[model samples]
Target: MEQNILDKANEWLTPTFDQDTQDRIKNMLAHAPKELEESFYKNLEFGTGGMRGIMGVGTNRINKYTLGKNTQGLSDYLKKSFPNETLKVVIAYDCRHNSDTLAKVVADVFSANGIHVYLFSEMRPTPELSFALKHLNCHAGIVLTASHNPPEYNGYKVYWQDGGQLVPPQDGEIIERIESLKYEDIQFQANENLIEYIDAAIDAAFAKSTIENCSFNTPTLAKENLKIVYTSLHGTSIKAIPGVLAQAGYTDVNIVKEQETPNGDFPTVKSPNPEEPEALTMALALADNIEADIVIGTDPDSDRLGVAVRDTHGKMILLNGNQTMVIMTAFLLEQWKRAGKIDGKQFIGSTIVSTPMMLELASAYDVECKVGLTGFKWIAKFIKDFPELKFIGGGEESFGFMVGDAVRDKDAVGACLLVCEIAAQAKASGSTLYQELINLYVDHGFYKEHLISLTKKGMDGLKEIDQMMINLRENPVSEIDGQRVVCIEDYKNSTAKNMFTGEITPISIPKSNVLIYYLEDGSKICARPSGTEPKIKFYFSVNAPLNRAEDFETVSQELDVKIKNIIAAMQLN
Candidate 1:
């Protein structure tokens, strides 16, 4: 065992820690040397978003001690940032195990530090937390949710006064404060007078704002006829989505009973992420049995949404995140145009890794589209930067969509309502949502996207991921699947190099460890390592013109073959 790790473990056995944590550490020290080393070798990093890891009794894990330290650091920063002001913050948690307990710890630390806290009375969706922060005019906010990770994982996410995750200087500053904290510096006691519990009033306001943001007016006869099915996947959406959907006038809706209740174990699914097919299994099954018009499922925090709609053959087909974004963007733009709300001052946002079809859609409506880094915090920053323009909606290819600017983060509740409204409009116009998707492809060019994620676990895995990025940059690929590589965009260095011209231009975005290769055939390949998880992700996008809707199947198959060829050429599969 490393001496440093043993020394760190020894400190936990002192009276500063609880008897239960001390006992667990003593047992691991006696018999589980490897586990002890893994737990104490290094501190769990508080990244730009915040900290996430396996829950356990160590500095390298998500536990009371780490959480308390983080809260104390945040409290100190808040005081420094807003000196002499009554510092206020809001807190929420999901269904993950220890989420409520961790939330209490966070609140206790803040209150103990003479900061005011507005904590949710029970579990709530993360987006609602964002809404509460902005509504109450708080200085900062915290939400405890691992967000679709395995059951053993838990996390903490920080938001600023803007109700978005920390960005640039703020993220770095908070991280610096957190790193300076010691276990002994964390205050674990609570001043009950400084803590207030928030409940129904906030929920009502959030639901009202969501309903008002819908482009379509109240439930029309068409919308009333739209049949829908939804599942929360044993997460926080169950507390909010159904109520919002009903308020939006969808009369016919079915809930997947098995996955409706909030459970940290996510009893009915292998993973709680709506992006994966397995997480939506029960919802899709319910949709098929009831022949519902569409199926919607949300992750643990209800910030992301996954959708399934019937294809041309009347078989249920899950739409990828890119496809969902395309459909939503198109529908939103069309609605805005119909309402004469688009006067060139409105815009939409997407990530660099998401499909370029969003840009085309925005252009069609004469609206500008802003591309940001992978996280929604960047999207929220765009909103802050361009206060003169209206932010209609934005999304990424990871099944996260935000319909309006009411909630700074990606919101599945509002997105769900908007999706149902689009479906109703489609059915009223003598078409299905799937057909509308094909129509969008025909209008804009057909764009297909695929994602490949490789997980590398533990300390060695971190080294390997770094080395993969280094190797790619050191010896870049010049060709892929018989196509010439025309451009290389290295986000880490904030440069876009034109291969043909050998000219490099600055990319106006925050530095992130990501690389993109543009092919001569108008295809784009992006490689990025997950900031919150132990994995690296590669995103591929290919496009072709669709002259007619009848050729949808043939064109889709051809695009699939092209993507497969590209993947094989890159040896990703």
Candidate 2:
């Protein structure tokens, strides 16, 4: 056993920690040195976003002590940032195990620091927390959720006053404050008078805002005629989605009863992530049995949603994040054009790693598509940065979307309503949602994207992922499947180099650890490490002209082959 690890373990046995925590530490020290080393090797990082880890008692785990330290630091920062004013913050949690208890601990720390706390009475969707804080005029907000991580994992995400995740200076500033504090410095005693439990009022307001923003003149008959099957995947969406649908006049919605209730274990699926096809198995089965028009499933926190619509052959086919994003952005653009709102003061937001079709679609509408770094927080920052331009909506190549600016995060509840509207209107016009997608490709270009994520587990895994990125940067690829690489965008260095001419141009975005290769044929490959998870992701996008709707499948297959060839040539397989 390392002396430093033992010393860290000994510090936890003191009276600063509770008896149960102390007992667990002693047991790990005596019987499970390896586990203890993993737990105490380092402090769980308050990364660019926030902290996430497997729940346990350690400096490197998601527990009362780790989260308490975060809250206390945030409390100190909030007071410093807003002096001479009453500071307020709202707190919400998802269905993950121990999330409720962890959230209360966070709230108590805030209240004990003389900050007023508005804690949710029960589990709520993550997006609602974003909305509640902004609606209640609070300075900050926190949500206890890991989004779609496995049963053992939980996380804490901080939101600023604009209802978006903390960005640039704020994230760095908060992390600094957190690192300067000790675990014993956290104030866990609750000030009951400063803490208030809230529900109903915020829920009603969020539902109403969702309906208003996403309804988009969707007729009552059209909504009634659409047959929809939805599953919460045993998470927090159940508390919000169904009611939002009813309020939006989507009464014919059917819930997958087996997965309707919130369960921390998420026993029905291997993982609770909507991005995985297996996560929506029960919902798809129900949709098939009922001959449904659409199937929707949201992750545990309800921040991201997966949609499966009946294809041209009446088969339930799942749409990837890029396809859904293009479909939704196109719909919103058309709506804006019809309403005469595209007066050149409107822009849509997307990430650099998303499909390039968004740029083309935005051009067709004579609006600018502001491309930023990954994450919806950048989109929210865009809205705040340019007050003159109206934000229609935006999404990334994840199972997340935001409709309007009502919620400054990827809002699954609002996105569900918007997607349902698109489906109902398509059905009313004698076209399925999938068919409408084909039409979109015909109008724009047929773009297909594929993502490959490689998970690396513990300490060594982080070093390996970092080395992989370093190798890609040092030894750049010049060709992909015989296609010449034209441009390379290294976001970390904020430089875009033209491979053919060797001319470099500056990238006007925040520095991030992302590298992108642009081929002469318009194929793009991006390598980025996941900020929230222990995974390195490779995103591949290819496009072809869709001159006719009848040739959609053939062109799509060609693009798929191109991506596969690129992957193989790069030895990524």
Candidate 3:
């Protein structure tokens, strides 16, 4: 069996794979049986998120073989989904390693299979692909992006006829078709004439929808410079962001020069996640030097966004994902109300683990806010299900936010443009965006969320994780860090238990292995195992209304201390 694996690996040692990938595979085969099995295990299954893995020349990696197989699966699924169909599928790629080549391979596979392919002439943002999927009314779509993952990874996201990620039975059906064939079964070429280049048409559609989605109807905030700083994080938003801001009439736009050029390796940041302050280090430095009013950064795919603002001390302060979502949603809701954009039937959505203040804020304004399972796909599902009811926006604590219904997926480029617009609008109102956020804290109460990931690698690691979950279920904790757990939501069992009455209620949302403990003090702790990575994540949320601005740091310190104590008590380092 080992020899068979080696032989299979050796076969890909051909000229099809680049020398670097070929050499890496050769090196992996020489010494690491454990690594080899992990690398080749059953081919990284492509589901709704499509495909993702560390880039390499293995059946398990996101190389040409995997990318081609996925495209073939999509082609087969598309044909079955729309029989007698002249299918059109739009394709886009990000700035991750092998993203462009993998996208071309996907285009080739689809076009070669007799599907009309609309390929981006160059690299584009992930949300633009989503917009193209809808604009062209494509039968399907594919975006080659690992999202906010580290440098070693890349991904392929499959969009369905509804311009959303494949969900439910369709997701399973596509996976089955992809598994039915080997690498050799994939089609990788096409009549080039059938593959049309799609650039200006889709770009125009995206820009038009984006501008239309801007809620700055009154433009009361345009009189000020706003002094905004934004970085693409060497991803896909370099050109369109500045262009959108310039078009939005903001003259004081500053871009981070060192990280201006798109590079897959992401030389500047250790990781390209805006949720982490370290990722925005360069942008913050630039903002301080330029004394910009606000700073924002996007990930490799530009679907998620991060922002920073100056504190009263005149120092750049990074906002967490919760803070970013809260501000955006609040700002949009206010603008919509002022412009009478609401029909009272309009709604928004957010994940369950996101800051709860959004649901309250939406309710206060007569806007419907529903909680869905994690991932933008679920949020998109809501958007597709309710065509009559408008979807104003949706976001998660993981730094994903999408505004308007222009695109089903998260749109960082759109959000980036809107953030600057919000800043300008606020400056015109004779206040800063930070002051607006503080006002929100005063209105909806303050919230701070902390995420802790514990990685467990290897097959044995999976078992250990399962055992941990089982233990947590069977021997449930009554308290953590001396705080009573008033309620426990077990997503695996789909039940919410009330500690006082011993009553159990079903969770209407999707069933997952996530558990949320709602404390009496309104703080929440959520434990969820990652579906893609070898890790379990714990989300800690704590907040206390500040009596005065002078006591903000004191309250923040208390929350941090509470989180540290809880983690320490749980023995989760």
Candidate 4:
């Protein structure tokens, strides 16, 4: 055993920690030296977002002690930021194991520190927590969920009064407060008077607000014809999505019973992430059984959404994040224009890794389109920066979408409703959702995107990822897939270099670890490390002109082959 790890593990045995935690530490020390080292060698980092890790009893894990310390830091920062005003925070949790317990611990810390706490009486989706922050006029909010990680993983995400994740100096300032504190500094005792339980009222209001963001009027005939299947993947959406769909006038909606229950284990899927096909297996099976018009699934926390639509051959096919974004963005803009709502002040947003078709759509509609960094927090920042403009909609390529500025994060509840409405309207117009996607490709040029994520686990994986980024920066590629590399955008350095012109332009965003290569043939490949996961992701995007819907197959295959060749040339496989 290393001396430092042994010393850190010894701290947990103090009288300050409970007997159960001390005993767990003792057990690890006696039998599991490797586990002890992994748990105590370093503290779990509270990154720009928040803390996420496997649940266990260690400074490097998501446990009662770690969560308490984080909450205490947040409480301290809140008091410092608004010394003259009364501080109030809202806390919500998902169905992850121990999430409910962690939420109460967070509330207890806040209440103990003289801050009013509005704790949900039941688990709720993460977006609802974001909405509650604004609706309740609170100072900040926290949600206990890991989004789509594996069963053993859990997280705590903090949001500000503006209903978005913390940004800039705030995130850094909060981290400084957290780092300055020790376990003994956390206030674990609860003040019952300052903690209030919230339920039904907030749910009703959030559901109503989500429904109001719908762009199209309810199509009674279409709603009756569109058969939909939905699964919450054993998370919080089971409490609200079906009700929202019903409110939107959809009569035929089926829920995947096997996954409808809010079970922390997520028994039916290997992972709770809707971005993966296996996560939607139960919903897809149910859709096939009922011959449903569309199948929709949300991640454990219900902020991200995945959809499967019947193709031209009447077989169900899942739509990637980019395709969903294009379809939803186009539908919203077209509806806004048809209703004479598209003034010059309306704008849409997309991340750099997302397909560029959004730019073309915004230009064609004569509206502004802004590109941000990877996270929806950046999109939220965009909305905050340009309050003069109306934010119509926006999304990324990771199955996350935000419609309207009502909620300042990626909202799966509202997204599910809007997507269902789109499907219904398409059905009424004598088409399928898949066909509508084809029409989008025909109108806007055909765009195809593929993402490959390579997971490298444990501490060594971190070093390997860093080395990969370093090598890419030091030895930049000049060509790929038989095409000259016309441009290289190093987001870390905030510069874009033109390979031919030798001109360097500034990228108007904060420094992040991202690299994008643009080929002369109009192909783009972006390399970025996941902020919330132990993985590095490569995003490939290629495009071609679609003359007609009949040639969809050929064009798609060509683009797929092109993506394969590009990946091979880059040796990503």
Candidate 5:
């Protein structure tokens, strides 16, 4: 172990820390030196969104001290930002182990600093915290969740008054303030008078907004006809989704009781993440047994959703984030056009790594499609920046979608409603969701996307991931599967270079550690590291013209093979 790591661990053994934390440090010092080093090697800083990590007794972990420090800094910053007002903030947590305790600790720190807190009485979806922040007219909000990460992991995400995660200057300023504070500086004493427990009323209001915003021209009979199988995957979505669906008149819904309970361990699945198909096995099986039209599963925090629909062969198939987003955005656009709302002043949002089909759809409707960096914070920022434009909806390729900007984040609750509306309307029109997707491809083009993540854990793993990016940057790939690399966009340096012409242009977006390559054949490959995890992700997207719906499977297979060939050629496997 390094001397600095040991020194940091020793500082946690002081009188400032609790006895249990001190005992754990002592045990690590006596018996688990490697674990100690891994736990204390570095402090868990806020990433593009917020702080997330494994839970334990170290600076690098999610615990009382680290979260306390964040809350203290945020409290000070909030006070400074709103000096003349009575500062108020709301806090919510998911069904993760230790989340409720950590949430109380955060509320205590904020209340100790003379800030009023509206803490949730029990576990709630993360998006509700965003909604409640603005609904309650609070200045900031915090939610204790690690999204789809394992039970051992937890996180703290800070939302501003706009209900979006901290972005740009605020993110950097809060990070600086957090770094300036020591563990001893965190105020843990609770001001009972300043802390209030909140529930029920907020849930009703959020469900109302979700229903109103996501519902379109779908008939009442259509909603009744759509049979759905839904699962919370042992997370917090159960607290809102079931009620929302019933209230929206979708009474033919089946809940996977095996996974409905809010267990932090996520006992029903290997991982609580909906993006993984295995996590939705129970719901899929239920859908099959019930002969349902659709299956929807939300992650622990209820921010990302995984969806499945019966294909042409009547086999249940999972749709990737891009597929879902394309379908949802197209549906929203068509509805808007029918309502005479798309007057060339409306726009939808997407990330750079998302499928290019979104742009095609936007062009078809004569609306703008703004692409931002990874993270929905940028999409939320779009609503703030371009107030003149009507913000329809937006999403990234991480199984996340935001509907109508009601909540300035990826909201699976509202997205779930939107998905059901699409499915319900399709069924009522004598079309299936899968057929609608194929029809969209016939109208636009067939686009397929694949994502692969390489996890590298521990301190050495971090260095290896960084070195991989470094190597890629130094020696860019000039070709992939015999296709010429026409352009390369380096977001880190904010530049896009044309390989053949040697022309360079500035990319007018916030700088991030991401790289993208565009091929002459219209293939795009993006390499980005996860902002919240120890994994690096590579996104591959390929598209082809679909003249008719009958050729959908053949063209889709071709694109899949093209993506696989690109992946193999790049040696990413």
Candidate 6:
């Protein structure tokens, strides 16, 4: 058994992994040897996002050793990319297990290499990290977080000089540098002189910037009579969310006690995601009891917002991500237009998988709407790609999103602040948020969307996922729920074709492993593999005009049923 495992370790210990890593592998083999093979069978590859895995002592796991290797590669690329330049980088961590330790490890490596480091003294929101990168003029940034993933998981996210996730040539270059390093060669020593803990200055800057953009018209909006409920879903948002609201003059904010504190396990919610209504159950119930005006939630890192508003029947109904994005975008555009804030060159970005209602609204309002591959990084890329255009806001169908470009990433903090401002705007007009949504739908046509994810895990399951993508690419489904395919947009192939008219066009977006089918009846189906998880997702979107407000309930219920029926018909369930 020892011999067999030794052969396995030798198979993977290429020159890039170094002597210390190989010695550790050998030492483990000498004791609990078979396990060592499992640990070092492969070096964790740098994914589209940064490194993420279960924490353990393995080349494939997320530990100090693995993180050091990743940081070393990133540092090398930073030096090459900014040679002869004064390079500064910001580092931050969430409340996940070992998040702070991993963040410090990253700081150590960069500081040891003589790069300036502005490290967060404690765990903070992901967006604040992005904000620091830009506010301090850092060339790069790193945040230790797995976002809403489960307790055992942790991750590394790299950012560019623009405060957005790295993109294209830079991302590829960093990956190359990381791939070139051996574990032993990573600069792991601390250079305390070059690394400074940043808390007060950045906190002040972030809060000041947020307050300066405060949109609420009156301090009276925060009166005790107007009860507001909030939850962090056991993530980092709780720390600053209340302070932010309080600073905004919202004194009546009630916290969901169970989820107020940051915990990596995300003890209260089964899944720490704000997109799912189930995750908001505790906060929703609390809001109902207090007759709250609104309920808001943020994911683990506090970059995305989940909102619940009083419906027509006065029930606290939660809005799905699509519905939430539509409301927020319409409100921002409307507010900007009414205030004459639109300079005619501003733009908003969203993923291709997000609801197209925003696209329609943007066109109607004469604002440019840009669609990128699914991820905030692409949104940031769009911001960087066009320096002249002001990126007002961006979001995805996932609960993760951003309301401003200040941080260059999805900011749950900014989202929370904006939602309060939006709520204030609604209250000032004598309409609840639900009513405001209906107003948008009444002016713009009604659109409803839903998503389904099929999880396929483990080694065999991983293979099956790959095969599923191949199968779909090979055998395209021409119809779903009896609607004939009108157009097929194969993002992988970078082509869009008319199934009937045979009209061909190029998709200007970057190539991704996504397939979208548009039906003759205007229904749409999209197939995409989860970038961060082992799941295949199918998104269905359907639209119908709402002739009257009374029909809102009936239409919404029907749309929900239609979405499920279509999913069943497609056998994605």
Q: Give the top-scoring candidate (TM-score).
A: 5
Question: Which residue runs does candidate 5 get wrong by more than 4 Å?
Answer: none
Model 4 C-alpha lDDT per residue in residues 172-277, reported as the tens digit of each score:
8998899899899999999999999999999999999998986378568889899999999999999889988888788899999999899999888998888999
The lDDT values for all models are 0.91, 0.92, 0.81, 0.91, 0.93, 0.81
Using lDDT as the measure, the top candidate is 5
lDDT of 6 by residue, 28-128 (tens): 86786556755655666545456666776676678887888888888888888888998899998999999998888889999999999999898898888
lDDT of 2 by residue, 1-573 (tens): 778888888999999999999999999988998899889888888553467898999888999999999899899999899999999999999999999999999999999999999999999999999999999999999999988888999999999999999998898899899999988899998998999999999999999898889888988899999999999999999999999999888889999999998999999999998899999899998998989999999999998989999876789988999888988999999999999889999999999989999999999999999999888999999999999999999899998899989899999999999999999999999888899899989988888999999999887888899999999999998988999999999999999999999999999999999999999999999999998889999999998999999998789889889999999998989
lDDT of 5 by residue, 1-573 (tens): 789998999999999999999999999999999999999999997775688999999999999999999999999899889999999999999999999999999999999999999999999999899999999999999999999988899999999989999998999998899899988899998999999999999999999999999998679999999999999999899999999999998989999999988999999889888889999999999999989999999999999999999999999999999999999999999989999988889999999999999999999999999999888889999998898998999898999999887799999999999999999999998999999999999999898899999999999999999998998899998999999999999999999999999999999999999999999999999998888999999999999999988888899889989999999999988
Winner of 5 and 6 under TM-score: 5
Question: In candidate 5, how many Å is residue 302 off?
Answer: 0.5
Clashing pairs in model 5?
A: none
Model 3 CA lDDT for position 30 = 81
Residue pairs clashing, model 6:
29-33, 303-412
Candidate 3 residue-wise lDDT at 169: 72
C-alpha TM-score for every candidate: 0.98, 0.98, 0.93, 0.98, 0.99, 0.93
Predicted structure 6: lDDT: 0.81
Whole-model lDDT, model 5: 0.93
Comparing candidate 2 with candidate 6, which one achieves the higher lDDT?
Answer: 2
For model 1, state the Cα shift of residue 199 in Å.
0.6
Comparing 3 and 4 by lDDT, which wins? 4
Which residue pairs clash within candidate 2? none
